[model samples]
Target chain A: DVKVTQSLRYLVKRTGEKVFLECVQDMDHENMFWYRQDPGLGLRLIYFSYDVKMKEKGDIPEGYSVSREKKERFSLILESASTNQTSMYLCASRSGGSYGYTFGSGTRLTVV
Target chain B: SQQGEEDPQALSIQEGENATMNCSYKTSINNLQWYRQNSGRGLVHLILIRSNEREKHSGRLRVTLDTSKKSSSLLITASRAADTASYFCATWANSGYALNFGKGTSLLVTP
Candidate 1:
């Protein structure tokens, strides 16, 4: 079975603080993604990495960035956290050209 | 910019009854996938149907795809209380590695 693990299940940060969410996958998948899920918006992509050091912006990438220094780890960074950034953040990974995906338990971020 | 939209945002059914949900996408897709998320948990991949295929099934779940209408349907037979969850439809676009997800349909199966 494939396992995707997130660094934190819940986090709280003050406004203007910096936050980091880490994700690791045991399957060595080539694609990693970060998404913020809201009540009515569904899972909107924030950023994705196809390979080490390669990143692309998704539909809602503002105030967020990603790092993929290694094949098994992907990190999402919030340069300056704001209250509006509070959300359920999910990390997902999939093998190259595969239809199935494995997702982390998700981090519920609270930016106060 | 959303790729898919699920119909009947929420549904409630008793145990042993069948639950059906529909999803419609806006653009051409390489494949469509269904995922289930329990309350406060990560999503679990349920099934996938390619654009060329019309229907697919696994165990008690059935999925149908209509490329011409750009829509798909998922049916869960003999649903139980444990089947309560939010079901989402995700689409893999022809060009990207990421899957675009719909808002999801929340299913409540009561005993």
Candidate 2:
């Protein structure tokens, strides 16, 4: 089965610390995305990469960055973690067509 | 920003009953999809209805799309206790493949 693996399931970070969330997919999909899910906000895209070394900002990219050095790995970085950034982070991967995204289990991050 | 709004923020139904949820979007869309997410896990894709299709069914799930009205509905018949989860509706944009999701409808199936 196709799988998207998130390195961490739960995390606690200090304010202003640099946080990294890693994601890897085995399907060799061209598109990988990072989204933060809040209670009422649903899922908002943080960043996405279509190919290696190519990245694009989404609706809520402030204070966040992404890296895609390899075809199957995509990473999300929090430049300076803040308390407001505490939420459930989800990683998803999809191909070029109209198929639905295969999402990872998600990482619940708490910034204190 | 979210492009779709799901009606009935919460619903509770007994087992063997049918549960229906509605979603309305603002603009034209290439397709609409339904996803189910457990309490704290990732979302599982349920079904997708294209712009050209009016209705489609998979197992006990039925999805209907009305492009002219910019609306869609998901119906799950003979619901079970394991069907308790949050259901979200996402729309594929006319120009891009990125999906814009709605807030979601929380459903509970009691024994």
Number of the predicted model whose DockQ against the real structure is largest: 1
Question: What lDDT is reached at residue A41 by model 2?
Answer: 83
After superposition, candidate 2 runs with Cα above 4 Å error: B93-95
Q: Write the per-residue lDDT of candidate 2 for residues B8-93, one digit (tens) a residue.
A: 88999999999999999999877789999999898899998889999999999999998889999999999999999999999864
DockQ score for model 2: 0.74
List model 1 lDDT by residue over A34-94, tens digit each: 9899998899999989998999998899999899999999999999999999999999999
lDDT of each: 0.93, 0.91
**Residue A39 C-alpha lDDT in model 1:** 92
Structural similarity to truth (TM-score) of each candidate: 0.98, 0.97
DockQ metric, candidate 1: 0.87
lDDT of 1 by residue, B62-92 (tens): 9999999999999999999999999999997
User: Interface RMSD of the predictions, in order shown?
Assistant: 0.8, 1.0
